[model samples]
Target: MAIARTWKSHSVLPGFGLALGFTILYLSLIVLIPLSATFIKSAELSLGEFWAVVTAPRALASYRLSFGAAAIGALLNAGFGLLTAWILVRYTFPGKRLVDAFVDLPFALPTAVAGIALTAVYAPNGWLGQWLEPLGIKVAFTPLGVVVALTFIGLPFVVRTVQPVLEDLEAEIEEAAACLGANRWQTFARVLLPALWPALITGFALAFARAVGEYGSVVFIAGNMPMISEISPLLIITKLEQHEYAGATAIAVVMLVASFALLLVINSLQWWVSHRHGRKQ
Candidate 1:
C-alpha cells in the first residue's frame, strides 16, 4: 500500500485559505489603503513643487533632527542594551526580576504621560534640570531633549530584541572556548558577537524607525521651535492645522521614501549577515 499524504487527505487548506484571506483583507483596510491614499495625495504635486516642499530648509532641518537623533539614540541603545541583556541572561541577583520587568515600562507607559514626566524632569527648572542648567547644559526645549525622548522610547526595542537572542545562546560554546584557552573578551568577540550581530542590527533598525515618526512623546518636550527643535511630524501637523494638506502630504511622501530606502539597506545587511552565518553552519 502507498504511504498516505496526510496533508492532502485532511483537506486542511480551506482553513488556511480563510485565514490568509482575512489577513490580507485586514491589512488592506488598515495599512495598504491609508498608505495608498498618501501616495495618491502626493501624486497631485508637480515634481518641482514636491521637491520644493520636501527640500525646503525648514523641512530639511526637521529631517536632520529626526533621523540624526534617532540614529544616535539607537546606537547608544545597542551598546547599553547588550549589557542589559547580558545582565538579565548571565546572572541572577536580588531584584533581577524587577530589573527585567522595568525594561517593559516604556511599552506600558502612556506616551503622553512619559512625555510629561520627561519634560518635568529635564526642563530648566525641573529637578535634574536645575543642576544641569547651572552648568549651561540644556536638555528640554532643545535638540538635546529630542535625543533624550528618542532614547527613552527607543531603548526598549534594543533590549527586547537582544534579550531573546541572548537567551537562546548556548553556554557550551563559551565553556569550550574557555577550555581551549580563550579569554572572556576573545571568546565573546569571536563566538558570541557573530550570533548576536543580526539581533543588534535589527534592534537598531527598530529603534531608529520608531524614533523617526515619534510625535506624542516628543512634542511636549520639543517646544516646537520652528526650524530648530521642530520635528517632521510636528511640521506635518502645523501644515495640517493651517489647512495646507498638499504640503503636508508632500513631506509625508518624502519621509515615506526615505524611510523605505533606509529599511531596505538595513534589511540587505541583515540578509547578508544571516546568509554568511548559514554558510558557516
Candidate 2:
C-alpha cells in the first residue's frame, strides 16, 4: 500500500514571520512604549491626586470644551466633507483639481501658520470678522474659534477618506436605483449612503481624534483662557510648564482613555453596520 502524500499550504508573500516580527517591534517602539510611559508616570500620583488633577474645575472645563468642540467639528466635517467629496467625484467644473488640492492644505501647512492665518482672517478687525462683527457673530478668541480651527484642520481627513470610496462607487448603481422607481433622495438614502457609511464613520473618528489633540492651531486662536477656550492639550502643556509632570500625565491618561472609549464605540457601530449590510445582501 502506498502512503498518501501530504502538502503544506503557504502564503505567497515570503517572510511572513519576519514581517510580523518587524510590525510588532515597530508598533512597540513607536506607539506602545510612549503610551505605557504616560501611564507609568501617572502612577506616581496617588489616586486622590490623580482624581483631584483630572476633576478640578478648570480641568473639567477644559475636558468639556475639548470634547464638545471636537464633536461639533467632526459633525460639521462629516456633512460638508461628504458634500465636497460628492461634488468632486460626480461633477466637472473649473478649478476642480485646484479645489481638490486645496482641501489638503491643512495637512501640509504648519499648524502655527494655519492658526496665524485663521486669526488674521477672523479677528474682529480682520476683513471677514469686520463684516460679521457688526452682526454680533464673533468667531476668533472664543470657544467658537476653537471649533472653527478644528473644523478647518479636520475637513481634510473626512474628504480624503470618503473621496476614494465615492470614486470607486460606480454611477450605474444610482441609475439602477432610479430605474427601480426610486427618487434621488431614496437612491441616496438607501443605495449610496449604505456603501459610504463605513468610510464616513472612519473619517469622522479620525477628524475627532485629530481635533482632540490639536494644540498649536487652537492655541493661537483660542486665547487660552483657562476655563473658557483652553483645551485639554493646552492644560497638559500648562502642567508641564509648571513642572507638574505627574499631573500632566494624569490629564493625558484621562484624555487617552476617553478618546479610546469613544473610538471603540464608533468602531463597534461601524462593524455592526457592515455586518447588517452584508446579511441583507
Candidate 3:
C-alpha cells in the first residue's frame, strides 16, 4: 500500500482523472450539445421528409460538387504541398524565407478576402483571366473557380502538416540509399515514401475536411448557380434564410455524418500505415 501511494504521487502528470473529466465536460458542452441540437431540430421532419430534403436534386448536385472539389483540392495540395515542404527543408536559396512566408498567406488571409481576390484575378477582364479566356478557360464564377478557391485555402494544411516531418528526416538517408546502388527513383519510392506516408495522409485529410466545410472562399467564385456551382454549405445557408430550418438542419446532419465517416477512414488508413512502418523498422 505504501509503494502504491508513492508510485501514484510520482506519476509524470498528476490529476489524470481531473483532466479527463474536464475534457469530457468541455466536449459535451461545446461539441456534443450543439450537434445534438441539430439532430433534434432536424427530427421534426418525418423519415420520408428528411430523405427528400437530403436527396433532392439540388442537394445532390451540391453534394457532388462540394465533395468533388474538396477531393481535387486536397489531391493537388498533397502533391504541391509536399514539394513545397521538400524544397524548404532540403534547400537554401535567395528569398527562401519569403517563399516560406508566402506559403502561409492563405491561412492568415480572411476567407471572404481570398474569395474576392481570386475572383478579381480570374475574372474574364482581370489580369490572368484575359490571357486565359482566349484559350477557352473560365475560372471566375464557375465550378473551376470553386476548385481554385478551395485549393488556395487548403494548401496551408498540407504544407504545415508535412513540413515538420520533412525537417525531422535526415538527408543522409537518401545518400545512404544511393551508396547502396539504388537509383534516385528507387531511393525515393522505397526509402522516403514510407516515412512520409502517414504525414501525407494526415495532410490530405486536413485539407479535404477544410475544403468540404469552406463557404466564404467558394461563394463568390462559384457564382451561386444552383445545381451547377452551388455548394452544400451555401445551400444550407440559403435554406436557413428561407426559414426552412428543418431542411437546413437535415442538410447539416448529412454533412456532419459524411465528414465524420470520411475522416474516420483516413485516420484509420494513417494508423495502419504507421503501424506497418513501425513493424518493418
Which 10 consecutive residues of model 3 have the lowest summed lDDT?
Answer: 1-10
Please give, for residues 1-281, the per-residue lDDT of candidate 1 as tens digits.
33486854656356877787999999999988998899899888899998999999999999999999889888988999889999999999999999999988988888888889999999988999999999999999999999999989888898998899989988998999999999999999988988888888999999899899889999989888878999999999998999988899999988888988998999799879966763465
Please report, as a residue range, the 10-residue window in candidate 2 with the lowest summed lDDT: 1-10
Off by over 4 Å in 3: 1-14
**Clash count, candidate 2:** 0
* Tens-digit per-residue lDDT, 55-77, candidate 2: 99999999999999999999999
- lDDT score for candidate 3 against the true structure: 0.94
Candidate 2 whole-model C-alpha lDDT, 0 to 1: 0.94
Q: Provide backbone clash counts, one per model.
A: 0, 0, 0
Candidate 2 residue runs with Cα over 4 Å from true position = 1-16, 278-280
Considering lDDT, which of the candidate structures 1 and 3 is the better prediction for this target? 3
**What is the TM-score (0 to 1) of candidate 1?**
0.90
- Per residue, candidate 3 scores C-alpha lDDT tens digits across 1-281 of 12455534656887988987999999999999999999999999999999999999999999999999999999999999999999999999999999999999999999999999999999999999999999999999999999999999999899998999888888899999999999999998898888899999999999999999999989989999999999999999999999999999999999999999999999999999977873465
